[model samples]
Target chain A: MHLRTPLPPRPRPARTTRRPLKHRARVLLLALCTIGATILVSAPSAQAYAPVEIVHTEQVQVGPYHLTVGFSKWPLRAMQSLDFTFAPDGGLTGKSGILSMTGPGMQGGMHMGGPLSRHPRKRDVWGLDVRSLSTAGQWSFTFTINGPHGQGTGTLDNITILAQPGPPLALSWTLCTLPVIGLIAFLVVAWRRHRPSRHLTVVGI
Target chain B: MDSVHAPTLTGPGQPSPPDHPPRPQPAGAAGAYTVLAGTLMSLVGVSWDVQWHVDVGPDTFFTLSHLMLYCGSAIAGIASLVMVLRATFAGRVGRPADPTVGGSPVRVFGGTFTAPLGYLVAGTGAALFLLYGLMDLWWHSLYGFDAVLNSPPHVALFISISLTMVGSVIVFAAARAQRWGRIGLVVSIPVLITFTPITTNAFNGVSPAIDPQLAGTVLFAVCFILMGGITLRRRGVALSIAAVLGVMQLFLWWFSPWAAKAYAAHVGLPLRDNLRHMPPQLPSGIPMFMLAAALVIEALLRLGRRRGWSGRWLPQLTGAVGGVVLSFSMLVQTSMLRGGAGAGPMGPSTTSATTVLTDAILGLAFGALAGYLAARFAVLLHLNAPATDQEGR
Candidate 1:
């Protein structure tokens, strides 16, 4: 018969009186640093002062109307969320407008049209709020304005939208699904590893 | 189980060991306990996601909240996978299936793999959840930026996770012989109860005196309380689950708001104008009458046993009775807390006599439905097949 041996009890640590002020100061400093870092990293990618900075403006003259089409971000990139503003010269009193967009992939120029509404945050001009174009190619914005000055139509054509920012969608999906494949392989290995002795007539059932 | 042969008698004066040995816990085991934890994390994440939508507007594909939600689902999936594969391997070797995996072993892949009913169901739910999650991203890409609760893909996701929670409940119900199993059952019942509540979170905002949304979710919650009694076949199982549920409810009450504000501040986003003065839209609440309803169920269940009642109707009746009691409980709580009568979070109360009556009536209808469904589910979980169905006994 084998003799049983009991495990030795773990020794308790000697109590040390820590400097509360010093410890608290370190913790407070760490917290402040973390807060400051988070604020810096997550600041919204918009100018805080003068929220809409119109980097590029295309002047479209349709009959007597002179319309200024403004883009918040220039060299427009597809899938890049930004603002689009349409400001008719001499302010917007008693003037109503509709904006329609036609892009390269759209067959026969079937326009995506809607009444131009003022941006919720920026009320001075008719605008699209945090919008993104899906395709990276030539696109056009058509504007229709109706007022005492009579109705007029204008188009800002050959507006190039660059390729979407970041890696390809397909590539992202492939990377995401890699773990799924790995999980399947792991399951197969696990099954084989724990499997009991296989003998007799039932072989590999 | 084949691993569990006849009790091993070590030597003279030594006691006979248990029929099955305790398995090691990996990521809190491929077991019921892990499912409980996983479901809770997922619900917390859901609460956070809802709050994020309310306060800060649209989110990208990856948020800290979304990650937490995905992590929860992944844990459940991994746990179910491990259990199923191990069980399948053992069955293929002509070994006895684990006793914890019920008598009616669900064979798959042309009878080659032995799948435990709970794990199979849970694994399938997890797979569906992941698929639906991917679909959610596509949905966002196709139709940009809107925060509606009952979106098609989001609903599909909720249903899948609910399936996982149901499977977790079955896991414990099947393993009632162990102490851990009993405790796990207690914990799991509460987790499952909250599963539907997260779907009704939108109602928590903007002043609805007696939220009609509560009726549907209360039905989901109260039925599970009855399930704790019916499936466990014990006197006080419902009460135990209700007690555990209170702890969860209290934690959520505190954690939901704190997490929402903390994350919003971290992201440097301002709260929307509507939500500037509101409380957190919690995914679930205490369900005010649960404790009382549980005691009622315990009494009725004990009485059923004493009378030697047999067959299916008892659970349904008990659930119906509990449902009514809970509806009234909600009525009392609302009256005391709202209608501009008290300092409740429901905001500038609109509770009228007519509204209260309407809520109670609707509550009654929902309660009956909840009871009827809970009865059938409890029975399904409790089903035991004859020994002839299994091999190498």
Candidate 2:
């Protein structure tokens, strides 16, 4: 048998006085920094956006301007974000345009409109980055352009919106069966190896 | 000599002193409850996430629903870890080791760590889920957006979550055999909720055209019948549980859409334009049928017990009957509601009589097979066994 050995006592901790003012100042600084960082991070992404796929593109003439308009994705689903670009033949040197959109789900005749800017990388391209479509149905987008010559409006109507895609066939089937397979395998192994040995004594039987 | 004379018995008829005081009723297993809560949270999160996807399209990995899902996983993982640690190191902390607190620990990883089997299983599942979450993020990045539900990463995640649910069931089953058995029934709420998604996958709201309603009905009927047979044992209790589950489903059918709408509004997320005009997806009529099926099974079991009928074929037989009942009920309900409440642009429009009949026949056959399989599996896993003080001893 081994004899027990005693250990030395632990040292007491030193006490310190609280500094309220310093703590308050530090907390205030931290809060401000956090808010500033959040805004800085979120601002750029909010302004410039692009769609996942480019579905449709067409050219139309309005007054002195010849414009090409593109819809980011086809058979659009509700709440999908996509880019709407208008490229003019002349250029967007001293010119600007407004893209006004109206759809089925809009509340009480309200239309969403935003200013289009010249593309940062491309010449003669001006576009409005639309965040999302609120509903699935026919939608109309009217682009009103103002240039040195005059103002002209071009409308793209009857754009069809479809429902979102359903579950992928192969993946869904495999996922549904995977757990069943696991259950079967576990049961099979347990039955072969452990069942007889613990048949009667195991609880809850 | 004086001591011996003084040590006389009170009387021959008097009862002797007890050897030891009766053990205090075992404490409610906190870990079991934690796991249950986590499971429920995960189910809700998944449902909301799906709605969000339908309404708002593809989003980043850091969405609110994803947070809720991961939070559930984290809770289960942490709770399991704590329980394992407490069980393994209780003696080191100058306390008498209590096996009942977290059940018994199994030596694993070449005897490196001693942990309760349920906890170990759950922890492994949690780890797998986290890994799959990362995989899902990578997959989304590579493939753009998976508009489909059954992506590879999602399947992995589902498998992991199922393992966690099974582990939770095993843990509570052990508790149910002891004085703390009542908690098992409580835990069943979350278990049922978690399993509901899996059993109903064949007839998910997204696939209205598929006439696999019969397959879904058979699957759940067999599952619920087995659950009733193994867990409740009493006819009235089983019936009550089935009724409660049905009521709960009805409530969820209404609550889910409302909750999704409320959440979307709160988060400033957009809703599908047509959804505002369209009715919500109809609740699968399985729960009501399950109640009827449970009653039938209870009656049969009682009859069999009185008649000294062989117990071997009972589950298979019950399953077959339950399947038939469920299929017929679903067919009738679908036929009645076909165009009125059942018709959604997203749902299948056709409900022909021929299809219903064929599905019913198939359901009956599958149900019997499922019933037999469930019985064998339950026995192998000791799922229906009574709780005992010592587990592997």
Candidate 3:
């Protein structure tokens, strides 16, 4: 008796082929391309900071509150006494405070002149309680700079205060545990083997 | 053809068998190892260099947890890349392709080009963001971008990343149509990460009106979801890592208040004053929960490695399980440590336990559901790695 045979399913089309470039040639091309691209992307940004002027902003994080003194072209560390207040808006209710400033000569930039006159003195930097930041807005601080040169007045604007905490959960422990568990498992297995091997040696009958 | 076919006869055969099935050829294990190594390195560079740590308590997004997030990525990326590249080259030497691994003969071009293009986009983005961050920092500290520490690094990172991306793309395109197509796709993620803006709002000063913590949490959650989905499609160690991330996110969110309080109390920081600076409260108890879920998925994917399963599926499974377990445990530990006045400078409030438990449960549920959904979707979408018999040459 003759049996009928079933035909096989049609095969999928073969993948197209190409003569791949040599690895060395490709690497060289890649390097050259990357260099050319880098030059294009970075040239503009580099030009933006050409004059190399220093911009300074004084900021202090006391407790949960943030007090930014604002941006200035000149160094205000030379000022002896500073006083500032906040207008009622969001959180602070006409709250004001004072901070005394004394520190080593401010480093970086020759804009501040020489060693502050060898005179021993305590400087008053302005302060604010900032007990609460209920409102989200800017605060202004006006400083009366009483430097030896003369009395200069400067205003600091839009000192923003962000209220937040660190990330609630931490995964460091978990990461650390991978090795720890492996180590512990290793130790446990080693102990089990060593103990049996050492204690179970057959004694002379 | 005759010379190549002559070696199979084991002996000076009395009668050579008519159709001796091609001798089971030795598989390309070395290539596999190289790809794995390359993937690990790439993972490290992307995670650490591109996305630096942001410190926020439970109120924020899922916890990044020091530098590990970056470190792990670097390890995974570099390792995978190395293994894949080596494997690709191994074919040149006439090594037999492993039956399980070399399914669906993809033209090297599409595979290579797409992957590198993705990386170029991502890497360039990250480099730009890094520059932005540096500028922001300079703005914060120096009031401008002139300082040496601040500006030069910014310039360097930006230029370097751009260059790297460009090279990466070229390599990808050049290597396109090779077996490294899938691997290239994976490596391109860091390049993508480079583009995402981690900070915003410059006119209003550096401080964000949008709580970074909250934003971060959401960002991590979204990443976790994507990761879970990716794992389902790829089916490997990556999923296990995702699971761990999800659990960790849950633990952090649930126990954030306590952890914050503990840190504050331990360090003698005031609670009301601190929370005041942050965004208004949300219902989220644990920001890290979602992250934990991601980690767990990744961990579980990795487990397949131990079971003699070597393929796309192992990474997702091992990654999912491991990530979740680690994240959850850490959360619990942190919460407990930070819960009481005696323990630290901060005092524990009523919301501590409730928040933590809720986060834990939610994380667990979400993680499980995500894993299930990912698996289901993979089947539905026909994303399964092609079997050798069905794979096209």
The DockQ figures for the candidates are 0.03, 0.06, 0.03
* Local error of candidate 2 at residue A15 (angstroms): 47
Once superposed on the true structure, which residue ranges of model 1 sit more than 4 Å away at CA? A1-205, B1-30, B200-212, B274-277, B283-286, B307-313, B333-344, B384-393
Q: What tens digits encode model 3's per-residue C-alpha lDDT throughout B1-393?
A: 011122211112222323422222223223333333333333333232221211121111112321332233333333333433443465445463322332212223433311222222223323343333333332323222221111232333333333333223223222222345334433433332222222111112234333332232333333434433332233442433334434433443344344444544554323332222221122122333433544454444444433546433343343334334533543554355445444432334333565556444544444444343334322311111212111212
Q: What local lDDT does model 1 show for residue A21?
A: 34
- Interface RMSD values for the candidates, listed in order? 14.5, 12.9, 21.8
TM-score order, best first, reads 2, 1, 3
Global CA lDDT computed for model 2: 0.56
Model 2, DockQ value?
0.06
Model 1 over residues B234-309: C-alpha lDDT tens digits? 6578898888888877777677777767886886655443333455565334575589888887887778767866
User: Which one wins by TM-score: 1 or 3?
Assistant: 1
Docking class of 2: incorrect
Candidate 2, B-chain TM? 0.78
Residue-wise lDDT of candidate 3 within A167-194, one digit each (tens)? 2112422322232244355335434433
Error of 2 at A48 (Å): 13
